[model samples]
Target: MKNIFKLSILGLGLALTLASCSPEDPIGSKVTYYPLITVNGDDFMSVEEGGTFNDPGAVATIGDEEVPVTTTYEGRFRGQTYNSTLGTSVADLYTASYAATNEDGFDGVATRTIYVGNTGDLVTSIEGLYRSTVTRNGALTAQYTDMEYVLIWKNSDGTYEISDAFGGYYDLGRAYGVGYITPGGVIVANDIPTNNFSFPGTQYNSGFGAPSEITAMTVDPATNSIDLTVVWTTTTTYTFQIHLDQVQL
Candidate 1:
């Protein structure tokens, strides 16, 4: 096993802090991560500032190009003894081919290349069917997996929603809304036209607290990772850097 240690997208300072000795969070010892997006060669896309894009790599450039980086060893699951490997390939959400490797000593990797244009040539990779492979001893088995609920940003309402009802749940007059609650027990979705709401009286189904703001959303040009940053209020904030490849199924 390689002593791989890198920083989480949370912050460079946080990464460094974790790299040294961290007791606040036991998971801090991990440094390497599976990139949510990655790039190779001419395939690329342009993302709006604050929008989310997914890919892999250490750094993302402005042109949607990702700098390729490698892990010393495969990543392990939360509590599993297995190590999983990810890669860039042609099989992807939009189009590309790649696969993740597991126990069989086979290289598990996947990749997809996209094109970017100034005006009409802009393109992005999307997700496709879920594919899985299992190998025991020397035998390999394949399985088709169903997708889980995907969280989406609603442009019209300027809120977010996570759904699992196969698209029919939100088709009617019901949709989940997110917000922040004030220390005084008031909940509101900033800039949204609805009144302060709660689980029963709210327009949407989800509420955090008040003063939460969308911090940063962008695509790294180097790794094509979709990074998100949000400030729940004056005192609390959250950031996420994710690669699209991790969303398989």
Candidate 2:
């Protein structure tokens, strides 16, 4: 049995060597050491509305040798779409990527998140933790009960930007996840106006339609909840209802 085990180990090592060795190498050699990038500041960073963003940048190294890194501040979610000047008075999400290329022409990249939000009186009044649920086409899509996974906070002139807009769906309802929030404009008589919001990993049928039929949009902390109706896969009928129930800050 011991001899059999040794033979198996020898066979596995041979297979690994054969897999690793290339025609050019003729030996099992690791790929060229690429530069590793590290972002300097917090992975999740924010800039208040009407404020400026100054990236702390990043560093790159190949072992002990320093290597040049290429950095970018993306203003849009769709790849590297860069707008001339990033607007501050809107609920916008962005990304910061640091990349270092090796001599072998391979790229090593690191990514972080950026949120543009407002810390206004109206926002503070409505920001809190909550029970949550989401539905598409009148069918349940997601929910959270025992744990208060829904968090809504912050604001902007064009939209009130917060943690998670999907409650607990697209990003586990975490602020630092792949999700961000945008409830647009100022509130008058506690009426939430129509707004368009988009997030990652969703393929909506048409455009992300308006949040038209809001059942309960309020600023009262004790019994605060939001019932938002949006058009989803079946366009025009307002087929999606995502809500923040029993809000508590």
Candidate 1 per-residue lDDT over residues 1-249, each given as its tens digit: 133333334467787887788556555453333333334443433333233334442332223333333322221111111112333221111223334332333343444432111111101321222111212122322221112212222222333321211111222112331121111111223422222222112122124333433333333334322333323332433222212212221
RMSD value for candidate 2:
12.6
Mind giving the per-residue lDDT tens digits that candidate 2 earns over 1-249?
999999999999999999888568467668578788888988877777568877787899987888887766674432334343444554345667788888888889998777654333332344434566766566663333323444444433333333433444444433244433322222223333232233223322112333432322434334456554443333355454566664221
For each candidate in the order shown, give its overall lDDT on alpha carbons. 0.27, 0.52
Tell me, by lDDT, which candidate is best. Answer: 2
Which prediction has the highest TM-score against the true structure?
2
User: Model 1: runs farther than 4 Å from truth?
Assistant: 1-150, 153-207, 220-224, 234-249
Clashes of 2: 2
Model 2 ranges off by over 4 Å: 1-31, 76-90, 123-132, 136-216, 222-225, 231-239, 245-249
**Candidate 1 lDDT score relative to the true structure:** 0.27
237: Cα error in model 1, Å: 5.3
